[model samples]
Target: MNKFKKSKEIKKIKKIHFMLFFIAFIIFIFLSFQNEEDILKKLDENVTFESIHYTGTLEIIRNNNKIIKTFECWAKNDLFLIIFKNPEDNGVKYLKKDGNLYVYFPSADDVLTISKSMMKQGFMGSDISNEDITRNRKLLDDYSIVSFNKIIEKDNIFYELTLQAKTKDVPYFMQKLIINSDFVAIKTEQYDLAKRLVKTIIVDEIKKFGSRYYPVKVTIQDGIKTSYKTIFSITDVSFNIPIDPKIFTIQNLYNK
Candidate 1:
């Protein structure tokens, strides 16, 4: 009877150990899957613009304070229809369609097409170039999030996300983006192949337009020599406004 009781106690101990191990394995698998699903959901929710249109005046500064240049810009979608109203150059327009970009230079009476090599060049000596404007990649489409953490901004809170490109065509392949909880990208840091800081973009003066928040002022700082800053102050902005597709054509660039 004593031997039988001992045997029964040993079996019970073994069963309990096995059950605990099994439960731990199941819990690990569940947590891993949940984490993956959360990442995909966050990427899907990153960029969600039904439609956007805005007109704003811009000023480009140097060394964070010196006024380098200024311009009045009108943009729709990813296209700049009217540029170079202030400063010097007149009636210059930048058009981007189907991933191809072209510049209409009214001052030179010539239309110069933009090549992939020139994508990094500044637009009219300003901090923002053609790539910065047109290469607005959707997080789900081109990048994979490596990590996400909280960051405190001056007036609000944000998530600092480290992302790496999943494709070769992405211009800013490796970047760290500061995205607000509402999915607004308030800041971005781009790096070059040598892991050097290439550019830093800051969005400020956020104002409520319709039901969404829009940045009325934007500043892009180049980390290289001749630091440039571009400031955009919105005069009028409306989302889902009636815009004809023809307004995005290259022919419309020269149209009065």
Candidate 2:
């Protein structure tokens, strides 16, 4: 009887251990999924603005020369218009609409169409190219979220989102976006078709305006050039305000 009782007790202990392990495993899976979903929600909210109008300073550094120009930009969805305020091209206007880009020259009294090759030249001498601006689409739409990992540095914790492009026509083949706990993008690594790092954008500051989050100051650095970088800072940011649709038309580029 003593031997039988001891055997029964051993079996009961083994069953309890198995149940505890199973419960922990289930909870771990649930938490993992929940965390990823929460991160995606925050990212979507941060980038998708209803409308934005702001004045910004664009600083370009190349070799030993530094050029600074201030501009006002208005954007709604995929369309945007930027009017340079100073430094020789004061009246220059850049407009992007309906999958096309154009530049209006006030001095020449003409509007020039822009293409991919022209976009590669950069936007208003800044590191932000036409391709970069027009990629207004959501990150999840273009790339697949492959991994989610927590990074602990010092006393701060962050989540790193690794993305791989789903299509060949994407501007970046791979990107690693580092976001804070609040889901604000702190930095991104942009890669080319050959899997070469081409550009890195670091968000210096973010401002909250009436429940909307905007990156007020950002630095875009050229990966290959290393020394070349462009700092963009915005002021007087207004969001979700009414804007005339006609203003985005090509004819309106000269008319209004």
Error of 1 at 31 (Å): 7.6
Query: For this target, which candidate reaches the highest lDDT against the unseen true structure?
Result: 2
Worst 10 residues of 1 by lDDT: 39-48
lDDT of each: 0.68, 0.85
The candidate maximizing TM-score is: 2
The TM-scores of all predictions, comma-separated, are: 0.74, 0.84
- Which segments of candidate 2 are over 4 A away from where they belong? 1-34
Residue 247, model 1: lDDT of: 76
Question: Per-residue lDDT for 27 in model 1?
Answer: 96
Deviation in Å, model 2, residue 106 alpha carbon = 1.2
Clashing pairs in 1: none
